[model samples]
Target: MTELDSTAFELLGSTGPFAELVSGFNVREPQLRMAAAVEQAIDAREQLVVEAGTGTGKTYAYLVPVLHSGKRAILSTGTRHLQDQLFHSDLPRVCEALGVQPKLALLKGRSNYLCLHRLQLTLEEGRFARRRQAAEVQAINDWSGRTRTGDVSELSDVPEDAPVWPRVTSTADNCLGSDCPSYRDCFVLKARRRAQEAEVVVVNHHLLSADMALKEEGFGELLPGAEVVVIDEAHQLPETAAQFFGLSLGSRQLQQLARDAKAEHLREAGDMQNLPDSADALDKAAADLRLAFGQGNRRLPWKDIRHKPEVESALADLRSVLEQLRTWLETAAPRGKGLEGCWHRAEQLAHKLARVCAEADGEYVQWLETYTRSFAIHLTPLNVAGIFQQQLARLPATWVFTSATLAVGQDFHHFTGQLGLHEPHTLQLESPFDFQSNSLLYVPPALPEPNSPSYTGAVMDHAEHLIEASGGRAFLLFTSHRALQAAADRLQESEYPVLVQGQMPKRELLRRFRELGNAVLLGTSSFWEGVDVRGEALSLVLIDKLPFAAPGDPVVQARIDRLREAGGNPFMEFQVPGAVITLKQGVGRLIRDAADRGVLVLCDPRLLNKPYGRVFRRSLPPMPLTRELREVEAFFAAGMTDKGEQARA
Candidate 1:
């Protein structure tokens, strides 16, 4: 292996651009270990797993090596927000510091950039909502005038979830290359070309998985040529990988395609009016799916429903129609330059639908997931371990997975095993923060069981007290959206300002919460991790329950049954570890800096009633523990008083 430069390390430790960039940040032993691991992974061409705690500067640690290494690499994150941050802010700062002018390109899943041809067609066709069309046209007009990279994220007004954007954007499944007249100015193709020539590329895990899954569909593959692939937010890998390997069809996607076809005049092909009938067919397919499932509310195993022949037949028919449609679209694509782009998009969508339909097997669980205004038919694999192993083994490039919550109770077994990672080098680096003085863990006593009728109310009572103590700076984390909404409603009239998740976009809500300073935020799932609220603004984190996957969930149930046949206790083998890692993530949200201090209030009485609670607590930072609500309040009040005195002095 190539040796790390000792003098360079010492110089970085002493003075230089590295010192300037990281001067405000504290580098501990774990961060150094992370830096070393990154270097070794690049040098030796081997897999490495380093789970660094929160506030560990994992981004810089990995970027340092990329700057120093002479080889090419691709860094894939889990979120578009992070992808934008790295490409726009993080990478530039690091590159400047190291004085390394490496060509870098940011490639998101193709859906993020504007497809000029599609946008122009949609606008001219008068297909979209008037206001939406006007706004998108204006944004794209401005985007086209200034965008060198063509990423639509440059428009601040456009939410990532906007329907108008997708209509104007291109996915791998829908992009036309050289055959399209707009190929010379295709944004996605332009970005991919830039990536092909660059030494370093930044991508999200979703796009990375898509590249891996659809290698033949794109330019070889996204990261296949790179020497090293570093995955940040690594705890999310298993779930993200499962999504790529599985299948899903949303009602919105089907409906949109039908609408777009009619608007774009593509439905004018042979026996034209027959196209709208296809929409009717899709509606019937949807109705049949819903009826077969019958008021689908709970997540259940596939075996439980496989006995119903009607349900199975409906699924088979849906898949068959999708396959036929795709085949028809592929063959009908016109050769005319102007019309060829539209033809290619139709074919690509067909192919993607067909690919997903093929993967929706009986081994995978299917469920109807309802949102407030939308719904989707989701198919998730019973166990992604085997699937990930199959995929990863094909690639020769080195992989490094790093996250603060990769290990449970200091054991990497649960995480690694879930990813089918065996005998890969594993290291659990301890937290750099001085937790003894920096934080406290408070498990409120006399709480109702999670299964009890009064569980939500009881948890909120404790949360109310914590918010009062912290002067309303707290994140009330729940295991379900129902529970989170309930708490938000209850706290709406409280003295402290309350910010709920669904009230606005996540980024907007977070912005409002930060601006409010002493506000109470209630959220589920997404907020449990990947949130960085430091110091006094966020002092208390209240967890409503242990975040175990719902036992009734089809995917969870199937995995549990799979393990049972293999002579394993499902609760201990699967449930406990998963919940432990999740709970740790929720707790780790507090104390992001050396001066930061806070209390973690776990409202789940099961931590006391159940035998597995110790595992969860042990995985968290070593902080003073108390079950008394009074003691928790006192600690927060003390921190507040000290802060006030410091400000006055």
Candidate 2:
């Protein structure tokens, strides 16, 4: 400890190893402070939460300390992209800079790995709906022979969402584990083994939450031995925890179970025609249940349609088919490990279906979601705090949660209360970049309320003016797909290239947006966060309205009702704070680096018309605010002048 403490000052100093090796690295006071705080928390084995604002170099801030400490730690990030960045990029750089060789491993969800058993089954079937899918499966088969890790991401030629993936990947229900021929070659198991032995393991929030919520019982020992857990993007943990802690019975799960059962029955129990018949019945029943929801997609409280004749009949049919399958599967359980696995999965699914379809439990909010071709019934717990706290108790380790937007106006209550963090240390580090000078917040005047029918038109009118000023390097983010579509429709004849979300894959869309350099992207909620376009690729950001969770959403409505029933103000306490964090994420896209400069145009008039707007005002970065059109144009003009001056220098 003494040796490391003496070297800490020189390690991240202006001319230190990090500055020498890493590109564009700067000595930040906040980064150093955060590192010290993380070190202290790791040493004392305490829980800590930090709201490290953007540009704090938070990745290196915690990485340096954890690498120096050499503890058995788990680093969970927000998404797969971040997981890859941390493990494949940041971790290696930090390890090299510190001259350490601590063993490291990256683990993703089971679905991300190629299942050799499933691949063989798919090959034996030798059938694909489309010629392209047939080619994709052959490509995967060729790659599977040589790939070491068996991670599907290794084959870049094939798209991630290709239908061939589901055919080749093993789900918990379908995996034969040690009883299968490919058990020794199972990529999921091998990854887990590597994670179990590594000093540091990198994972995503969804996978980490699955383990914490006990969703994957007895699956692996990934989290049990960790001395410290660093959760980046902690702001997303509560929602992810809620999802994992809940129970869900979806059409896809049922359909997969049916498909696998039929396939296995053909090979293992060919003499038993009853097994295949039952599998087909179950599959048809699941699709019928989806059909009961009709064509339009929506989410509603289960009670809303529980008594509908069509839906009720479909539900009954599904349960009957599921029970019949279980009965037949019981008879054929001794056929093989595959049959035995199907029987177990049917039992579990039946139990989940019974629980989900039954009367609502007060602890969980029962809801049903109908997609275009599928439906899912969920029992999301009203609160994940207790469930989360229990898991944290079981794993008594130093826990740290950090994100750029965890706090609302310097208050962490909204985040802390969600996960039941007890007396945990909290730190808020403002971004080191000069936001006040580098960015301007523009709220065009005379706009109608967001709920008004003419709102999209009014917002786009100002969006165009701002886009012209900034030369169309812009992201016009909306709260709803309808609004984004409406805006996209209006900009068809515009001079600048317009890229709309859903026109292509998100990664490819972002790639083209960057390459075009002056393109306008119109996107909905997913675009608000996790999409980073730094430098001149993106300079102006226009958010259509305050990103309030849809009040009509079943889960959101249930939470609001629950809170209100308990004599709490759900609007101010929950919705506003959540929206503030979301808006902060949108605002964050403008200025990613110290040299980055841009304009943020917030079109929501509620920001100024309503009194609650003050909370949002204080929560945003300390940027220059404006409601005048001339000022926005002037800000961009001055930005152009700065660029010209830099170019001359």
Candidate 3:
């Protein structure tokens, strides 16, 4: 490997190569320092964790080193938006600046690509029951005919959650693979092949987790040949990894399996008796299982549901139906390859469901979640750190995990411990922006505690004054949907436009918030992070409470129970640091750019009364902290006055 000189690192800093390549580029010390750290980690083949504050240009910082190193690397991001941005915009710009041409491929999960076989089957069967569904199918068909990539995102007219999408896309359980007539033109296969041959592959966290677990479609792997893996938005990795390592079986999956089995049997099983009846029976059993859950959407532990006679009976009947279906499929196995695949899927599903239902060992937590029309059973491990550590140990490569919020109060223990990375190289680079001058952390005095009955009203009253001060250019973030709605209702009387989260989609709401320029958006956890709006349009961020995961959540409860059993302090070890990271994300949403300035309102009184509150205060950016309402008003007033003076001058 050729050693890159200091000048190469300098090129990434201010007044270097970026000044010539990027428009409106400013030299940032933190960005340069991060780039150097990444380059060193890559060169030395070391594990690195970095918490680069927002505006550090960490994307290009890591991209420059990874691309310039001439090593095949897997770049995994937390969202498809960032994946697309890196592949289409950031990677290309950095490669151009470095004067290097590397083969790059963007790969998403199988669901994002159109399956020609599924599309043809849906079209041939005329499965569209609604006019809107038919229109969406037609739109997808039209796009498929003209498109090369077969990416669903290319169809701008099609909403992502369209009901017709599931009918036209392939899942691992349903895909016929090389046995299908459309195998040669499979978009998913083509994308994976390209990714395999590329020097750099861009994927999301879910896809990376799927790869790590060897659960990728067609039993393929993407990480074997890569020399380095860079996981962006690393704070989300532990949760995503947990999901990948867990076992999940849903009613919808069973229904789909039954449908596919019956269809395949009909086409290939030459007069096989009782096959269709068995499939119908399996479908009925799935419906019965869903009904056994009673009403409403909820999650219940196995201990609570197993003792119920009705649930037990329903489970036994479901198991019997699955066994019968599996027997029929096995007896008719000589039909064709497609029928054989269906039989294998049914067998696997039956065994998995049986294991999940029967196993209540201490290592795993078994729970059931019921939706309005369907339900799911899951077996999630109490801890995934050990499993993830094993996976990392098996892969011989440099691992880099980075995010804007990964540390709490200069400590990386919570983040590192969750991933089981002991003694990895760590760096924390604060945002170079002048937070002291550009922001104010306002905690109003005399507010009730977060758990108090009057806390919602108190939060709304204070948020109303702050929103009025900033003229509705604010994001009123809440810790729960209930609080968000209450705030929305109380603020409805205001003259400015108010946009709540559930009224429309998040992207649309953000768009409207930006265009209105002075609209107040009320949202819960989703709005706290991965949202950016610059200039005077978003000058205030109001958080209702510290974002602690609800103790009622089954996963959270299970983890807490496990920690307590192990004689560990769950509250201090898990809850506090997690809330601190979340609060930091909420605050980070305010000052996205160097010139942006804003006021942050944290309405939770515990920040002052509780001793642990110091962790949250210390973790946040070093913005000017204040406890008075007039100080907030005066800050905005002075900003307006300065704008007026600049206009006149």
Candidate 4:
């Protein structure tokens, strides 16, 4: 390995050229130390795990090194928001600061790009069922004529979860590849080509996993030639990797195949034969299978599903129709632009169904979820460590995994062990922010336990006091939707504007919260992490409970059982550390910048009562602790007075 050059190392320091080129660049020792570690990892071709706290400027720390290394690298983040920040914002500024321009590409999953063929088909078939749907389709069609990248993100007017998106965008199962009518101008293909040739590629964890698993077509492997792979929000990689490694077959996939088959038949003007009837039968069988789940949405283990006669009958019927459809598609030998894609989808779906129904393996936990209109069979691995280790072995690239929440009390074992990395170089950098004065960890005394019947009301009562003290600039984060709804109900008549999670999209809700400057936003899991709200707009973050996976969840139960069977302490080894990391993420949301000041309210008494409470305390930032609501009110009042003084000055 080549020795690290002083020139590259010097650039990270406060007096370096970076500081001169970038405006308002602060000289943070942690950021410089992290940058050095990243550079060394790349030069030595070894794995590195880093935990850089909230104000460490971890992004620029790693970006400077990766860009300076001049190596083909893949930078994967956990969310598209971060991906965009890196690709569109941070990368450009850092590259300019370094006076080097590297070829860069931002690639997302296939579904993020527009498929011209699918759009044309949707338009030709007049598939819009509502006025809004038609308008959305028309908007996309109009945008398609001018979008240079064809990224769905360009259509900010369209909601991310719009029903028309799936119809207009193509998935792996439905894409026709070179056989596509729009092959010459395919947005996904163009993006892939750019990524294959770029010096740096920015992608989300899911896309990176798909490429690592070789699940995506057209691109045989996404990271083969890259020299360094830096994963931001690396904590999410293990779960995302497990999801990609596992097999899932949803009713929607089957229905989409049937729809595509019918479309192909119509486009080809081919003999219908029994193709249409088979498609109808498959659709009906899928509907029957959904009905067999009875009512409401729930996930159940194979044991529970096996004993239900209705579910069993519906599964048998669905399996029969899928097999019949696959055979018909195979025998028909339909010659058309899209028929082959449909046939391939049918074959793959049939095989997946067979695999999902087979006897569960010891390493995997097989379960099924019944949604309102669709059902899916899932086979999630009990542990992803082994699978991830094998993938690492396959790709001999320098690996760097960094996240703010990867370590608990200065230990990276919980994070590294999940990814099968035994002893990679490890670094823990505390946030440079003066948390001792800027933040307060407030735990009100005499609160009801999280599981108590009166817990929600109690939490609301406390939260209302905190919000009122902070002048309604707070985030009321709940562990469950039930608690969130209950809190929303209790706070409905408050003087402050209440923004619930489902009332609008997450981004919109955040925008409103920031704009209102004194609104309370109630949300669940999605808001726990990857949410960035800085300044006086968010002064208090109230967590109703410790963020622990519900023990009743089939997957969680299976994992606990597996841990027990292996003779490990499930509570200490799995549950406590996991919850600690989650709590850390929730707390990290409050202090984003050096000037940001906020009060974090952890309503869960477990932090003070449980034997493992110390673990949670040690994992959080070193902030002053308080138990008195009056202290919280005093802190806010002091903060307001400070602001007033600054304004007068």
Question: Which portions of model 3 miss their true places by more than 4 Å?
Answer: 1-8, 218-220, 265-274, 331-333
lDDT of 3 by residue, 140-226 (tens): 998998999999989989988787888889887788888877899999999999998899999998888877775655324668788
Residue 537 lDDT in candidate 3? 88
Evaluate all candidate structures by whole-model CA lDDT and list the values in order: 0.74, 0.88, 0.87, 0.87
Question: What residue pairs are clashing in model 2?
Answer: none
Give the runs in model 2 whose Cα sits over 4 Å from its true position.
1-9, 215-220
How many backbone clashes does every candidate have? 0, 0, 1, 0
Scanning candidate 1 in windows of ten residues, the lowest lDDT window is: 2-11
The TM-scores, one per candidate, come to 0.90, 0.97, 0.96, 0.97
In model 1, state the lDDT of residue 52: 86
The candidate with the higher lDDT, 2 or 3, is 2
In angstroms, the error of model 4 at 368 is 1.4
Candidate 1 deviant stretches above 4 angstroms: 1-8, 15-17, 20-25, 129-133, 216-219, 264-271, 276-363, 372-375
**Following a full C-alpha superposition, what root-mean-square deviation does model 3 have from the true structure?**
2.1
Q: Is 1 or 2 the stronger prediction by TM-score?
A: 2
Q: Model 3: clashing residue pairs?
A: 14-27
Candidate 1 vs candidate 2, lDDT winner = 2
